[model samples]
Target: MLADFDDACGKIGLQLNLTKTMFMRNGWVPDAPFSLNGTNISECSSHVYVGREVNMMNDLAPELGRRKRAAWGAYKSIEDVVKKTKNIRLRAHLFNTMVLPALTYASETWTLRKQDENAVIVIERSIERVMLGMTRLTQVRAGIRSSTLRQQSKIRDAAVYAKSSKIRWAGHVMRLNDHRWTRAVSDWTPRNVKRTTGRPSIRWSDFFTKSFKERCDALRVSRTDRTHWTTLARERDKWKNCWRPLGLPDDQRESRSRSRSSWALVPPRKQEAGVNLSFGVQSSNKRSFLHFLSNIKTVSVESIFETAFTV
Candidate 1:
């Protein structure tokens, strides 16, 4: 392939820069010897192309760390302004507009996992703590701050923002005709190629599919409608709200526990005698059984029995 490329370039009066070029393998394939114009082309585990690092194993830790460092630098540049600003909103605005873009540059292309999300959240929470002038120690001591507090304000999680950006990009790509390279590559699958052993690497499209289902339940009905999909993607506030932390207040937690206990004590609804009941057995031992049932949609008694016994 390199020889053919070199030949084609020569025909067009162009030269291949072997010094600047790198070859990378997509999967767990051993490196093969290759040369371009008698110069050996080095194989690399990863390479930075168009500003984003493309890794053979699809690991984003290095890239994410780089972004975090860049973001910290950006924040440091405006740290004085952030500290002196009387308005919390102004500080937040500055962080969002100036620092976040640096942190999340090219995030749309990332295949994020739970660990990646947690890492981004840690950085974000650190920034938020800085803005509020509270360290981890102080925050723990403060305990149960009011909702109006600056720290309590629900800032959009960086991982959620990245996922949303990818969804928006996906919608754009889906709108493109079949002839587009982006569209074609998105749907392409290698023929008769077996994956390397062990766990398969996560793909950006897999994240898209999962996130779309979670955030856009109406996706199937609206996907073909470009305007609808666009509207869904543009609802940044809605997406942000959806991604808010699930922590509950102390009072709510206490009430929930009490309610669960009370529900557990309630007599079971009458059922045919001698008909084996899964809940009847579970309720005798597990106080949390009723709590779980409350959250689930109504199911047939027989199906519930089958499920419990199968488990």
Candidate 2:
């Protein structure tokens, strides 16, 4: 196991030259390729190896604290190393092609689950409708007061043709304001309607509310002063321009490019175990390498938790 240490050190740019420093000369060469003699080796019993490893672990405790404080700086250092060591274009392709597809697959699985839940809700709604068919229905009608009935009729008429563009209910109501029938006519004009050359319409309910009248008095700005859809459209265009540097293509280009590529989306392949790919066998080991590290971590954490919360 010790014979491989020098190669590992070389891989991480920690190679030591014996003549360069006194530490190396004092038989503490940190990057010696191998130890043939007992010069850098301990000839003690089994306890010596455990003691040295414990000391190494103790040294790592301060390193762990330092790493926690400077995590972002460490991340930038790692990114720099990766950029220096790998092909940038290949990395981009792997991220966009492979990693993106895996992420999309996971997302689509969640979406599919949501769709299934919605389908179940629809089924439940249909069952409820079927259950409602078992109940008996009875119709009822009564005579309405003259003035209230007239107002209700006008409201019903306005609601019936609400979507009609040709019907100018606002103009009709304004012309009939001098007539007695105008008292029964509800404010048929839209509440938030904009008029080019006329006074803006007010809510009929607001006439009965003191607080709403006070609020209207305070708000002196006209409807034209408020931001509208045109403002939002300009902001949307600004955002679209901001994303232009990501090399996204127009819809036409995207369609044409996708047609040329033979990419496909399929359900992820999940094997129980021992499924051999061209790369390697899928060993059915219950524990991962991370599990071993986690076990060691849990022991340290348990010690801390025990000390802190002892009854």
Q: What are the C-alpha RMSDs, in order, of all predicted structures?
A: 18.5, 35.4
CA displacement after TM-score superposition, residue 215 of candidate 1 (Å): 7.8
**Worst 10 contiguous positions by lDDT, candidate 2:** 157-166
Across 1-311, the per-residue lDDT of candidate 1 in tens digits comes to 45665677789899878887666554334446657667887777766654566554667788788888888988899999988877655666787777877787776567777798778867867777876677877877878442334334334446545654555455555554645434544556656566668986666667535544543443343555323333443344332223222221121123322211100101123222232111111112121221122122223333332332222
Clashes of each: 0, 0
> Would you estimate the TM-scores of all the predictions?
0.63, 0.13
- What tens-digit string does per-residue lDDT give for candidate 2 at 134-156? 21121113333322322211111
Which residue runs does candidate 1 get wrong by more than 4 Å? 1-15, 28-30, 144-154, 196-199, 211-311
Q: Which stretches of candidate 2 lie over 4 Å from their true place?
A: 1-38, 42-60, 75-311
Q: Flag clash pairs in model 1.
A: none
